[model samples]
Target: MRLDKYLKVSRLIKRRTLAKQIADKGRIEVNDRTAKSATEVKVGDQITIHYGDRTVRIKVLALNLIAKKNEAQDLYQRLD
Candidate 1:
């Protein structure tokens, strides 16, 4: 799945547009390498997002194109 879509579907960023913007700005990484909005996200991949002074790291556990509010958290495992 696309990184931006994964973020939104997983409720990481709340919106696909915001996730795309952030990814395009080089603020997101996959497996420690810079990732683009269209980057492919696979199960078990680690995603690190830089949110200004704060950083969030998570491991992708599943990919769901449409997920319920409570199911969003099941898509990724927070690492930090």
Candidate 2:
């Protein structure tokens, strides 16, 4: 799955557009390397996102096309 879509689907960023913008700006990383919006996300990959005043790290647990709000958290496991 695309990095941006994974973020939204996993409820990390709340919106795909915002995730895309952040990824484009080089604020996101996958497996310790800078990642683009279209970067492929795979299970077990670590994703790190730099927010304004903090950072979030998570490990991809699964990849699905859609997830309900209540089930979104199951898609990734927070690492920080």
lDDT of candidates 1 onward, in order:
0.98, 0.96
Write the residue-wise lDDT of candidate 1 on 1-80 in tens digits. 99999999999998999999999999999999999999999999999999999999999999988999999999999998
TM-score: model 1 vs. ground truth: 0.98
RMSD of each: 0.4, 0.5
Cα error, residue 6 of model 1, in Å, equals 0.1
User: Model 1, poorest ten-residue lDDT window?
Assistant: 61-70
- TM-score per candidate: 0.98, 0.97
- Cα lDDT of model 2 by residue, 1-80, tens digit: 99999999998998999999999999999999999999999999999999989999999999999999999999989998
RMSD of 1: 0.4
- Give the range where candidate 2 is weakest over 10 consecutive residues by summed lDDT: 71-80
Cα lDDT, model 1, residue 53:
100
